[model samples]
Target: MRLLSREIKLCSVLVFLFLFSLKVLAQPPAHDPSKIMRDGDRYWTFKTELGIGAISASNNDFSDWQSEPSVFGDTWPSWINTYVPDFAGHFWAPACIFLNGKYYLYYSCSTMGSHVSAIGLATSPSLNNPDWTDQGMVVYSDGNNTATVSNAIDPAIFKDDDGKAWMTYGSWFGGISIVELDTLTGKTVGEKTTLVGGNHQDIEASFLLKHDDYYYLFVNRGLCCRGVESTYYIQVGRASSVTGPYDGWRTFLQTNGRYIGPGHIGYNEGRLTYHVYDRDDDGTAKMMNTTLDWSDGWPVAVEVTQDPPGELLPDGTYRIQSFDSTKIVGVANNSPYEGANVEILDFSDDNINGTSWVINNVNLHQYQIAPKNYINLGLDVYNCVGDDDANIGLWSYWGGQCQKWIFVDMGNKNYQIRSALSNKPIQVNGTFESGTNIVQMSNNSNDTTQLFTLVLLELEDTTYNQYPQVVSYSSQQSGNPASNIIDGNNSDGYRWSAENFPQYVVIDYGDTLSISGTKIWTYQNRAYQYTVEFDTDIDFSDPYIVDRRTNTSAGQPITDNFEPVAARYARLTVTGAYDYTGPWVSITEFEIIEEEIVGADELTLNDNTKIYPNPVVDVLNIQLPAELSSGADLAIYNMMGQLVFRKTGLKGNIELMNLSNLKKGIYSLIITNNKTFVTKRFVKY
Candidate 1:
């Protein structure tokens, strides 16, 4: 009866969605460009633009600088070979965390069978290292014995505030499941619990995060992996515990203007958000889509804003309440041909507003012509081509005829197209050259005797059928010799060594601190020579070498203990190599635990203090009982260390400052009046 019910439900879904049973094959489509997002200084996004299909990882390897943005758009560095060999596959759904000085990247891979789906683990001391050690399969589900769905994929790992490690995974199964893990070893420790289950179709690519004592579970639903037909969308539920009978299941797509199929919720800038799995300009299925917002209890489609407590628009969009555009200069088109109409065709919507002249209608006759002539205009013409038959045609009246035939100012200035035949209005001899003379001429105003016809044309794609490329490095170099090779490998003189080094931890002297302990981990049978260097500058030269240590031992973990020193920056230099080269050593983790030391010192100064009302709407008022000292600095910094305001001391009893420019977040106020230093924290709401 259960089998019959399953068959009946499948038939009903097919009928409702009007899906055909044509033995469809799920293959990576061409022109899959995923949206890219910025995480701090590094850009993290799925690599679909290169048309390489679903990329598993971006190969960020220090030794292999070329490994970044992995050849096939996979961010996973090639270094995993140093640890796991069965790591080869279309591995995707990467969740990375920096814990205990090591980067743990958890991802999943699958072949044709649902039971074959498995989650894998890889670790690297650095994100940009080619040396990733595959920790092997963390979990696997075969359809025969496991749950209804054999696909055990989409793994997300997180450590709670209490120092407990947890992983949530599963897809097309009953629902999402949460499992506890042994932190020391990436192995499951507790029994898997069905956190949430329902009749709704849930393909678990669950992202579990805690906010305000609530654990949020984000899951993907409906059909996914279909290029244009993928009904990928996101839903959220919250529970007080990691493994919960989560309530408040809300579908973000139910909102207006809300796009379909948002999946893979990732924390961006410390906020919960999901990726939009939608069609690209060419209608290709893209795994890396735009970001969605989850500020409110329910998920809303919103833009990423640096400001906290931003507003959610009526259309479910986010507005950066604190963004100031008054200081920005508006883009103006000064060229005479700015308003001219240019016919564009055959190009995908992605390239429509770009600078490239990718036109439709591959045939020469179908090319688009500029709406107006390039008579008088000073503009930059980009990828447009000229007509072979005409010497002079319509041109804008700009300084040079070429300038008249300029492309419009598109964002990023990459897809602009200009007429190819525009020439200088004034001839060399103060006379325009008659027909067909513009051909073979350079940008010479003195040769104005040559009249030119500006014509629009398109170019063909050159990188068709080309597989992603990677650089092969020679193993003879040592001590990060590859670091010098910033560009592509060319001259043997061009290649440099790239190595991973440990970063030092430091504490300020102003704070009374007592060092409790220090821990370090060295991976593989690697010997390392460590030197403690100190200097104000981070340069290698002129460093004060404080201490050094060398380990000739060959084995697995190594531990060292030492006393702590108060310094601004600690420098750790490794020498002896391990694994692949000479004196190679990779430090997996280094930590320094400290405790606060209390002291008793008495100093007092009498001064006037004044603050405004408890609640401030637009402006905040500050008053002083006495005139402030000259040259004193008043500054306001946000929680993220961004300076929002700075001013000098003024001789006024009361000061009115505009708080409208500030975002709804916490800020620190530093006022240096006379010789006294004062610091206070305030909330801007």
Candidate 2:
């Protein structure tokens, strides 16, 4: 199962729509977009006005960005347009959040030059499940029409270190005001208090950051929203409390080069993500990011380094969890049937019983999910329908297109699973209910029910019959010692080499077993030639040369397969080198392979049989006097009688067996499972 999630396709469509609207209206969506909110490392910029398009960036880098599908429909959720006719339906200065499995987007809506604006809220559980519902207006300015009580637009949510949340919003009409927020629902909980005010000429965009013992208030001052002519710049002030008559209102960041209107700052980690009107490009707003250099307790913006998007798992089984609740997503015992439902639960006794999922990659980080135990079962579309709200279920795998899924990574390790067949998302039918069945639904915004996390599991081990024991080297160089090769460390610093040509290393396997191949890793330098040989005797009296390398050197691990040979000892001898220093042999890792046939060895088959080529190199001829039995077996064993190779079904009078797959060694051949028997001895030389 693929452990990767990102909805690049959905974002592309959203960007196209935004660009299309820009063409029709002949105007940009929002002027100088506001604060950047990040979930884990994923970043977004919600444009001000109407549809409030949220564009995306990677590694918090806004360079050449992405746009989420626009919330189109007359540019605003239809539910609120009736309440505020003069509201302009323009969603602006949006502040986003993921709290309790829901995304609370607090935004501003107002007409041209009107302090009579409203800060409305929208809620979504999954970013990929774009079902953003308006939570109605939070708090808008209703006081005297003067700058003192000005409450118009520009909203910012400040979450503090103590878990308390507050909001600061307003434009030039009234300065900035702070209000406590209801923790359960991100809306105004009590009356507001004024923090700072000025003549409606130079103030707006309040961003709060809790650093050290101070709450730093950042705001944009002067005329904004005039495209390349906008003169807005950011300034900052700090207080020990959220509401305050603060100090140090100095320039935070200003227009540079082709950048203008540098405001609406959001601080994460040590960097600040914001936007600016560009005189370059198309004279539209572009996202800009930077870290900060601090001096005398104030800050200066420095250049930033962006990171690439995250990667998928290296390929393995993993347990899927609900990112919102930390619960495991698994098939309920009763739900393993075709029409059964899937659930996310809080407890588990056995992970492999049903929790393990096999990830079959479809493409581009998308995968088909199946249970490890129920190997043929997959997440499927139930009773298949092409309309809205189709059902989801687990069923016997028939390789249907509906079984494919893609994960969209919501920041903070959360993922939304979308079907490759329907292009819809899967979400728990309800809230964090322990055993809710997952259903397919359309995405509008963030919803907790649709999120999941893929976690890794330990791998099972395999057993080997024989392995290399003692290693003897002919000679070694001073710095490149022979012992380094067998140390089991392939790091650059550890390796082995022979100082002179005609150098060799002898490896002894404690007992004789059929050796099939050897794997080797060499140093970076390409200058040596070598050959591998095996023999039953230590001195290699009649050594069988297994493989050879003439004059080239390559770095990666190389595997050379040969005819299976029973050898207690094997040797690698270097014959030549081209290094300027001298002829030297270097190796990082060397592995010997033992070939074993599982249930392939049988000594007898019904009736008479004759075998030719006592010592074979490529093909051995087997002759049968009459027709053979259905289950007739052919197996070869080494001198030690260990089954090395075998095949089922024997027929025809003259049957040829390819001996090229076996290592050169003395061996016994057997044919027959029951009824009758045939046995003989042969050697692959």
Candidate 1 lDDT over 229-298, as tens digits, reads: 2345566778888888787665544101112244566664433334332221222232222234457555
Q: Each candidate's root-mean-square deviation in Å?
A: 29.0, 30.1
Candidate 2 accuracy as lDDT: 0.60
**lDDT of all the models against the reference?**
0.39, 0.60
For model 1, the run of ten residues with the poorest summed lDDT = 4-13
lDDT of 2 by residue, 1-685 (tens): 0000110000111111122111111122334354555654566666654467776555454544566675544567554555446654446667876677777888776655554557788887755546878777787655356447756567788777777788888775567888888867888887888787533324678888876677788887644555444556788888887888677556677654345567677666455666665543434565555566667677666643211112233334678887667677777763567766677766566545467776644323445577766645678867544334666678755333467576666777677777654456687776777776677877644777777787767322100111243234545555665545555676657777765545556665544556789767777745456667777644343456754545454545666787677566677766555453454567776677867533433222323566666557788898765534355787775533345778888766677988798864456576654434455655466
Poorly placed runs, candidate 2 (over 4 Å): 1-34, 38-42, 62-64, 75-79, 304-685
The model with the greatest lDDT is: 2
The candidate maximizing TM-score is: 2
Q: Model 2 Cα displacement at 40 (Å)? A: 6.9
